[model samples]
Target: MATASHPHEHRTDGLVVTSWFAPGRINLIGEHTDYNDGFVLPFALAVGCTATVSQAAQDWSVRSAQEPEPVVVRRSGLAGADAVPEWTRYVLGALWLLTDRGIDVPPLEVTVDSDVPTGAGLSSSAALVCSVVRAVGDHLGLDLDDDAVFALTRDVENDAVGAPTGGMDQLVSLRGEAGHVLLCDMRSHDTRPVPLDLAGHGLSVLVADTRAPHKHSDGEYGARRRGCEEAARILGVPALRDVSGEGLADALGRLDDDELRRYVRHVVTEDERVLAVARLLDEGRLPDIGQALTASHRSMRDDFRITVPEVDTAVDALLSAGALGARMTGGGFGGCVIGLLPEGDVEAAGDAVRRAFADAGFGEPSLFTASAEAGARRV
Candidate 1:
């Protein structure tokens, strides 16, 4: 994990400032299955967003390093969500939700900076919300539990930001552990911190950010989610999670609409894959999970139709370079691909993908190694 810059206290108009850090999450296996009440295995990334906040005297203002102008809102001006700049909406959403839920959120000045690459499907927005929420909780001395924080942050994205995201990103960002992947049960909202000692096993996860822009609010994502809901309705189940792997073939046979059928197949099978990967992790069979990762990429590409060419190319190149298994990670369309391979081959595998992209005339990709890291914390 990259080290956070040391937090130094300074008096600005006699107000002390503090900082908090939250991590972007990488889903190890599950894709587009979180909202289906299925299973997801995500780990916190080393890179994330940091929020520095201080109690302001009156008006609330937020400034991001990525944005030129700071967003200022009057304490009473919380009704118009669209009044603020597009990026500051996340910050405003957090404040508005917390205050609406009876958390006495004081007007504050927040300056943000992040290493989490936006639009890379790394859950950068969730990291920002989690970080800012931590700052708010810390400043108010509120001892909110994980579930409360998760619900609030998740709502910040879903209702406040108008993104139809599942709660996986907020949950993982809040509960992720060092050297562990969070096994999130979307049905019961339960979590298990499964150990993933990759370095000890002479393995590493290579992340290739295709840098293809994707947004949760985009129509394609919403359509996939709607398709899942419609599939569940047609299947007579509360969620796709209830559709067991053993019953998958029977379920698919019932759906006449080819698109909805594909959605059901992916969610049902993806849930099964998540459990399969978790069992392998428990058994210390890290290498065996590689095939599952590659299979997941195929499911997203063929069944869910979320993979773009850049992601497909990265996965193909990684496998050709001898990666044990590889697949596109995140919400798909355009995002990063994760490969499980021997740690010694990280360089060669990255180089191979670089060459593949150059040959395909695609933009150069960002390659990095990510280990399981801790979740949101005060710095």
Candidate 2:
């Protein structure tokens, strides 16, 4: 982890503005499996959230250029799911979770800006959540470990913010290394650092934002997690990780509901894909990993029901344009699709995707190549 001078070391006009950059993440595989206690391989992207924070004299205050009114919450009186807007919940939730963990910190004021497109499935929320949490930790002089920091961020999203999310986003955001992917074990919180050597293949990763935003508060994401939990309960396991692909099949055979069977299949298959990708990376077999990426996308689309038509179209367009693999990256409903392609072909592939979307009458999308960047740090 990178460290910086304390926020108090630099003050201006009676306020100390500490800026932190929290990288957005892309799931290389294992979609919708993190909440299931299954594996997920997410790499931090160069694109991310940047937050400027200063201590507040009165209460915890937040003001975003993206919003109209400043949100206020007391240090002892943090905002909950009901009182906070969705956009502000990331910061509020982080504070609540950190406080619950006994990190008694004072109130703060935060402002955020980001290149990571919201609702693009590139983990804009995670970036924002991690940034605020890190900034607050620094301001409070808390010397928490990376795991503790990640836990605080996860709790904010899953509990205080009322989003049924997994630990992958927060974990990667806090622990990611430049030029590497974090192969995270959601079940044990263990991470394996895998080298991301895309340059050797002359490949670049293009993230195309569909401009369709997904809000986890809507319950679609939560419902899927509930379904996985139900499957785990029926299988007599702690989580879906305890059930293998064949084991899931055997468990589903006892169930009469087709929907339940499909959900189990996705979880089991996704877990297998994640492990496969990790193994391939370990062996330096980068090209073979693309197959797992494509398969994971298909599973998320067909079984998880998270990918929307626009996302599907984007992936298809990129694949047709010679992308080695393409998939929707985030919580799914509407977001960005990431494509792995030869660096020389990136522009052409992006142009082809744009034309395809225009033909379909969808809004023009934003495209950019992301580096495998470092995680959260004071700037």
Candidate 3:
């Protein structure tokens, strides 16, 4: 990931300040399995959100270069769900969530800025919330451990932003290492640190933003989430996580509805793919994991039906350009595609994708090379 300078960084120009960072994340193999209480393999990106806070004479206020009108929130109204300044609710809601967990919210002026691309499925929202939380924690002198950080940021996203994202984004954002992938079991909430050596294995991670608006607030994302839950209920299992190994066939046969079966199948199989990728990474066999990544894209496209035309086109172009493997990485519909390409071929791969998009009359995608980086912490 190419790092960009954000406004929140480096501010000693005649004002006292506190700055904290939260990095964006990319899932290498697993997709749409986290909400089903399954496995995910994700790594933090160098690109991330940063928050800068300084004392204000008035109540809590927030400003960002991305938006007009600084958001001001009164501490009294923070407890209400109908908080003011809707766009900045992520920050406001975080204050309330923290208070709910018995931490005191301090009044401060917060300016949140991010280099993480919005709506590209790189966990930008999570990064933003985590960055804000870190800034607030830093300002208030509240010691929020990693676990509290994960839960509070996730609650802000789900409750305040009304985004029905699973816990993977926040978990990875909180616990990421500079050179490791977090293998998190959503069902168990058990996390294992796995080493990542993409460049060492002659690979480069490419992220292509198709520039499609991707928001999980819509019914499309929630519908799939509910469908997966229903499928788990119908199968009489706690979740799809239980239907693995030799028992997978039995679980598939037990499902009566074809649509429900498809959802369950994707979860079960995708979870297995996460484990496969983790194992491959462990053995230093990065090239062999390409097939699993492609298979994940196919399952999301055919069975889960989340991949848009732009996503498919970009993935196809990357694969055709001799990428090791290509797939849509985020909550799918319209977002970005992550591909593992041979080192030194990213420019050609990017060219091929741009040309393919141009030929298809689609908007040009923003392509960037991604590298693993550290997670949220105060600067």
Candidate 3 per-residue lDDT, tens place, 1-379, comes to 1012334334566556778889999988788899888999999988888888776776778898788789776664346657576658877777777667666566768898888888888988888898888777666666667777677788898887888988898888888888889999998778888888887888898999999868878899999999888888887888778887678778879878888888888888999899999998899888898999999999999999999999999999999999989999989889889899998899999999999999999998999988878888777
The RMSD of every model to the true structure, in order and in angstroms, is 3.7, 2.7, 4.4
Q: Return the TM-score for candidate 3, rounded to 2 decimals.
A: 0.93
1-379: candidate 2 lDDT, tens digit per residue: 1223653335778566677889888877778888888888889988888777777787778888677898887665344557767788887777776666666657678888777777777788889999888877776667778878888888878877777788889899888998888888898999988987899868888888888789766789888888888877877889888888767668888667777778888889889988888888788887777777888789889888899878899999999999888888888899888888889989999999899899999999888888788889888
Residue 6 lDDT in candidate 1:
23
Per-residue error (Å), model 1, residue 165? 0.6
**Highest TM-score model number:** 1
Error of 1 at 241 (Å): 0.5
Tens-digit lDDT track of model 1 for 267-310: 98999899999999999889899999999999999999999999
Return the top candidate by lDDT: 1
Q: By TM-score, how accurate is candidate 1?
A: 0.95
Residue-level lDDT for 41 in candidate 3 = 93
Off-target runs (Cα >4 Å) in candidate 1 are 1-13
Relative to the true structure, how large is the alpha-carbon lDDT of every model? 0.88, 0.82, 0.84
